[model samples]
Target: MTVDRRPGGVLELRGVAGGYGGATVVRDLDLTVGSGEALAVLGASGSGKTTVLRMIAGLHPVSAGRILVDGRRVDPLPAQHRGIGLVPQQGALFPHLSVAKNVGFGLVPVDPLARWRSRRERAARVREVLDLVGLADRADDRPSRLSGGQQQRVALARALAPGSGLILLDEPFSALDAALRGRVRAEVSALLAESGATSVLVTHDRA
Candidate 1:
C-alpha cells in the first residue's frame, strides 16, 4: 500500500468537555493526533468513550473547549461538512439500500468534478472501498443478508468512501468474530496508514 505524501489532517481536542444537558462526561480533555495516526480511547461502561466521539462528530454539542481539524475549528460545522468519517458502534447501515449504494452514498455530493459526478463513478469508488474491507463481491447484497462482521465492514466502507481526513470509530470491530477481528483490524490499520487517514477509535473493550 502506498502512503499519501500530504498531511492526513491533524485532529486536536483542547480542554474539551461536553455531555447531555446538566451532565458532564468528558472533562478538560486535551489530545493531539497527528496525520495518519490512530488514537484509541478505552474505558469501561458509562465511562464516556461514546460521548467523546459524539461530541467530536457534532452529534452531541460541545459545552466547552474546541475541536480542530487540520487547525480549523470544526464545532461550528455540521458532521458532513467537517470532513469526518464516522462508524458508530451499531454499524448504522441503511437497511433499505444495497451494500454498494450504502457505501457510495457519501461520494455523490462529496466529489465535485462532473466526471466523478456520474453514478458509475460512485459505483466504481464503492467497489474500491469494499475491496479494501474484503467485501467486494457482496456489493449487491442487502445489509440484512450479511453476517455481523460483514455488516460492520459495509458501515466501515461507507465511512471510508468519502476519504475523510478524520475517522471516528466507535467500537468498530465489536461485531466481528474473534478470528475475523484481528485480520480486519490489521487491514484497516494498513488502509488508514496508506491513505493517510487520521483516526480515533472509542472502545470499552478491555482486552
Candidate 2:
C-alpha cells in the first residue's frame, strides 16, 4: 500500500478527567501520542476506557483538563470539528449506505479546506481509503452484506476518509470472532502506522 503523508497528527491529553453525571470515571489522565504512534488503553469492562476516548473525541464533556491535537486545543471544538477520527465498537456502518458512501461520509464538509467539495474528489478519496483497507472490490456492497470484519474495515475507512490526524478506536473488533479479531486488529494497527495517524485503542483485550 502507498503511504500518504500529512501534517499535524500529534495528540496530547493533559490531566484529562470526565465521567457521567456526578461521578468521575477517568481522572488526571496525561499522555502524548506522537505522529505515527499507536497507544493501547487496556481496561476491564466499566473501567472508563471508552470515556477517555469520548472525552478526546468530544462526544462526552470533559469535566477537567485539556485535549490538544498538534498543539491546538480541540476540546473546545465540537466532535465534527475536532479533526479526530473515531471507529466505535461493532463498526457502526450505516445499513442504508453502500460501502463507498459509508466511507465518504466524513470527507464532506469536515475538511477545513473543503478539498473534497466535488463528487469526483470525494469518490476518489473513498476509493483510496477502501484500497488501503483492502476493500476496493466491495465498494458497491451494503454494510449488511459484509462480514463482521469487513464492516469494521469500512468503519475504519470512514474514519480515515477525511484524513483525520488522530483516530480513536473504541473496541472496534469486539464483534468479530476470536481469529478474525486478531487478524483485523493487526491489520488496523499496521494501516494506522502506514497512514501516520496517531491512534488510541481502548479495549479489554491485552493482545
**CA RMSD, predictions in order:** 2.8, 1.6
Which window of 10 residues has the lowest lDDT sum in candidate 2?
Answer: 1-10
**Highest lDDT among the candidates is held by which one?**
2
Model 2 segments beyond 4 Å from truth? 1-3, 110-112
What TM-score does each of the candidates earn? 0.87, 0.94
lDDT by residue (1-207, candidate 2, tens digit) is 453446538899999999888999999999999887888999999999999999999999999999999889989899988878999997878899999999998877756576688889888888789998899999999998998888988988888888787889999988888989888888888778767788899999888
Worst 10 residues of 1 by lDDT: 1-10
lDDT of 1 at 199: 88
Residue-by-residue lDDT tens digits, candidate 1, 1-207: 221234467999999998776889889999999988988899988999899998889898898999998899998788767878898877888899999989988886744542247777677777778887778888999999997777877887787777677889999888777888887677667767765678899887654
